[model samples]
Target: MTGNTLGLDKILNALFTPYKERVPDVNKITQAMVAKGLINDDSEILNDHIAFRTLGVPHLGIASFEKIFLHYGYKKKSSYVFDKKKLDAFWYEPPYSHYPRIFLSELRVSDLSKQAQNIISKYTSSIITDPVDAIDLNDYEKVGSFFYKPLWKLPSKEDYLLLLKESEYAAWVIYNRYYLNHYTISVHELPGQYSKLENFNTFLESIGITLNTSGGIVKTSKDGLLKQSSSVAKIIKAKFANDEEHMISGSYVEFAERLVLPEFKSIPKKKLTKEHRRDGFESANADKIFESTYLEQTTKNIN
Candidate 1:
């Protein structure tokens, strides 16, 4: 979505490759959409945005992770704080309208209990410099590989469980550093019947997709202009530092619908464009959407 179109494509491919493998729901949902004529191919579905989770520590977190996208012409936008969840996040606007927006969030390590902080710091403390700063951002291959690179040694299972008991977000970063947390699909871009989230959610459920039911099936903004839903993260068996293995929550896929802004409501349906629709995310909606990776949602019994 910038002058470096070819470069961005390569980098995005790198990020999505592993995410797709880890989150099979992605291919499952996309393939189902194809059967229902929702899209011709994978590329037709608009990626509303992609999210990243980080540990808020020196030389890491948003300040460092964002450098990659920002270098590709993504501009930082709104800031959000989740007091209860102990998170701080910002959404970035893409250089071109076609590019997916970026959502970057960090666990507020200082807000956690002393014990929890120590668990996270054990691994992250060794990052003495912003690793992104050392790389040539212009080198697409290097930048692409950076997302999957481990910033520090893996944490022991005991440390991971201790962190999980305090903050699930912390435990995730300790193992899944810089991994693409979730990528969203713009449901508003689907066919008329499936363009609405409620209808789309039904379609999702029909294919055996378990949705995150934190606040409700549909997480709506106060203004009701933006609505979102996400799949419960799949449980992946992880082999920890000491050869201990356990099934843990992994990345998920999200679906979003952005209604036409009140000011642009009069635009003809046939002529409507993204510029005519509501933009950006809603904190209240996001607050619940974050639960996709949470244990309650992921471990909820499917009916």
Candidate 2:
């Protein structure tokens, strides 16, 4: 049968002719053109055949060319690696053979006291010792100390298509403000507090998100507010769990309406042990001296 008479040949010819016209140098396009008689003279064509040889097929119309042949009516089948086989290979591979791979980093505490050491030991069971070990302590600290449970294998092409759809849905919900806003508290040292807020506001502004201070309270701008609020809710829930007694009753919902800007500040509590109390006292004195010196410098600048 003529090459055009074959089903795969016909489909490929149709898919590739327009592509060839746009770019004649494309190997697939040139091959399809020669097969379809659009290109003249076999001698004029580059007869290298290396591309076809890599696929264990002899003819230019056979190796990378086979998919188009299959599209036609060539009733031949072979054991080509399919999506399922690739996914299976990924799961069975080393480092992933363990049901869930854990990422770990080195622990760095100036004084690894008994209490601190015990806490570190409990979580270090699943520590990843090799690839992550080379990273500096500061870089590791950014991710925080936590265990991550691998949920599933890396997504397949089909999985990614589904994820795209889900992402679209999520974007829609966020644009529409489908959920309620809740409080989010970020804890850091006192010196970095105001600067952090300013930086965060600048980020929001860059993204066309306005900061609303209506009702004398701070709130997120109208756009993308829902998604931002959901994130805040998660942070609030985590903080409330950490210190239940200190949380204000109905604070989350009220904060949403009042739109009060959240600030990071130190939470003081009585030390549980005498040693802890002494440590706190020493730290407080150092902070006091630092603040006084800072104030004196500021007053001089004003004068």
Candidate 3:
């Protein structure tokens, strides 16, 4: 898909197109959010990060999916493990200061039950080689197209539910392979009333967006620097193997607002600086946000 190196903004717009098509609320909510904050245009709002889920098997994992972002000048930042959820993730930093960070997580297939493992392996086994290794990293369009490309066949409806019972994340990636799980909005960049997550959340609720409250309406870090919230996934009709169709939960969009660390308060308001603003993903906050796609949460909020 690449003829020459494309600009970062162009790449992002192309990447977000399909996601916005599926979750129309993103465009609506974002536009309204900027208006509430009294921002003159949508360009003023900053995105914190975008996250994706993958199956940790032979040909598909962070190692395979991460090449696209890495080719776009993103570097690995931190690693996190969710033992209870059987998941591992890492956040990547961008080459430019203005670009959004990338957070990626993969389900540990080996940790699942025998039946679940077999179901997962049955599909990914076809990918005998690492696909990312074959991509031309210098080709931006080629790398961008790789994000939506399907590496394996669809899962059977019966096998899908079985995996869901044991691992919600696993079921998600199995069906929604290479889809953008969520895009985070940097609310810290908003104006006065909407600068804090608490207020911004209230604004979101007023507009009829149901958020993931697994941890709480607002999830905060121990230090109170990072706060996150996500709308429940919008369930849409998905066609599985054997031509069976059912309405299943798809991806959701996430909103995050970061605050300056206590020590950084010494700087003047105008002089506080971008360095003062909190950066990176919080393991605690992210852990709960991941529940946005759980069956229990999406069942009530099908859209």
Q: Whose TM-score is greatest here?
A: 1
Estimate candidate 2's alpha-carbon lDDT, on a 0 to 1 scale: 0.22
lDDT tens digits by residue: candidate 3, 1-303:
222235566668767889989986687787786666557676776878888898899878999888777767788989999888999999999887677889999888898899999999889898989998888777566667877887888889998998888988888888988888888878777778787888888988898888888899899988888889989988889999999997788878888877887888788666665578787877888889999998878876854
**TM accuracy, model 1:** 0.97
Q: What TM-score fits each model?
A: 0.97, 0.16, 0.94
- What C-alpha lDDT values do all the predictions have? 0.90, 0.22, 0.83
Candidate 3, residue 73: lDDT: 76
Q: Give the count of colliding residue pairs in each prediction.
A: 0, 4, 0
**Candidate 2: clashing pairs of residues:** 7-72, 7-73, 8-72, 218-259
Tell me the lDDT of candidate 1: 0.90
Worst 10 residues of 2 by lDDT: 85-94
Estimate the lDDT of model 3: 0.83
Ranking by TM-score: 1, 3, 2
